[model samples]
Target: MNLPATDRRVLVSGASRGLGRAVAQAFAANGDRVAVHYGSRASDARLTLESLAGEGHVLVGGDVSDPAGAARVADEAGQALGGIDVLVNNAAVNDPHPLATTSYEEWAEQWQRHMSVNLLGTALLSHRAARSMIDRGTGGRIVNVGSRGAFRGEPDYPAYGATKAAVHALGQSLAVSLAPYGIGVASVAPGFIETERVAHRLVGEEGEAIRAQSPFGRVASAQEVAEAVLWLASPAAEWSSGTVLDLNGASYLRT
Candidate 1:
């Protein structure tokens, strides 16, 4: 995993644990100064902070739903590492509730939380990063952590799915607009990842059935998904802009 010495600064949101943690670690392992952002998870943030692969870690704590939070993260990262070269938007909320029985408050809360962080927050940071990249006259990369639920439907969690869909759409538009400025925007969507929070969502046989659905007969790991993000941000994939790489094991096809 040889990374260019020049690509040393990257920002990852929701990096306290799980997929976000893996993405942060991936960049850190390759010698990138990582800004690990967490929303309301101080202890988890501390644990992730300890596990960072490099000394250039900057802890950014904030509510990603806040519009100003993304810009603040960029500011902190710039102050910590001199500049940021990559931005990974992975903060998300996925509390499941059936739409039929879902309360207006629940829907509004989820939308405000997820959309604000996942979509709006991501845009804000990417916007800031783009400005910096333009001023430096070099290309930059924006990798968005999206979900298969955006294209496919889940039994529950309609709000979560919708927000993911919006993320994809937003990525596409950003990719087009940012290209002239030497900025690459892409989305990485994963299917049925095996994470601690999702363990409770499955029963004994239910888990097996879900695994069987994938051609690989297994769920994706956080590290696996993170690897995809790394590649997209890497110079090797410089020409690959506006791409939505589905990291699923052929479980579901986009088209």
Candidate 2:
């Protein structure tokens, strides 16, 4: 990616590993100061901070599922970064629970957890960061990490898909509301990604079927998604706000 025109203070949530870690590294490489936030992975977050290219990166641990906790985490990051110019909402949890086999209790728990972490967590974090940027009188950006399941639907993980859909909708709403404040909002919807967390599924018997979902015959990589987030948060792409960029390698087309 091209270097940013100016140094930015960036806060990346769920940056302990995978895509979040990559996003943090990209920002650091762009000469941006970063606050890496993780829900319950201090060691992994430390590794991300250590892997960052530049100095002045801090690791923050907090449970974003709680509104107060999310605010606290955002406050700490904003202070450490001397005010944030970018916020990447990437923290989420996905657990499989198909309706055919799931009890009502299990379904209820899944929805609650999914909404808490995926939608509420992101909205609360963005609210805090946006408020900070408004007070600072500096235009900033908020990029949400969304998923293709939001558009295509998920039979086994309905809660995951529903929350992602909400995330995208939330981005568009914020884009309109925060436009005057100069805080652009957007999201990236990606298909199956090649990550350690899902390595077993990718290499399983259904591996070929998964790859065949895309015309490229392969899933996307963490770095690819990170690159997209990096660009969306850049000034040049401010006009792209409210857009949900599809990074699924042509796997699922939305009309």
TM-score of each: 0.93, 0.97
Q: Please give the RMSD to the true structure for each candidate, in Å.
A: 2.4, 2.2
Alpha-carbon error at 214 in model 1, in Å? 0.7
Q: What pairs collide in candidate 1?
A: none
lDDT of 1 at 98: 83
Candidates in order have lDDT scores of 0.83, 0.92
After superposition, candidate 2 runs with Cα above 4 Å error: 1-4
Give the per-residue lDDT of model 1 (tens digit) for 147-178.
99888876587767888888888888989998
Clashes of each: 0, 0
lDDT of 1 at 138: 69
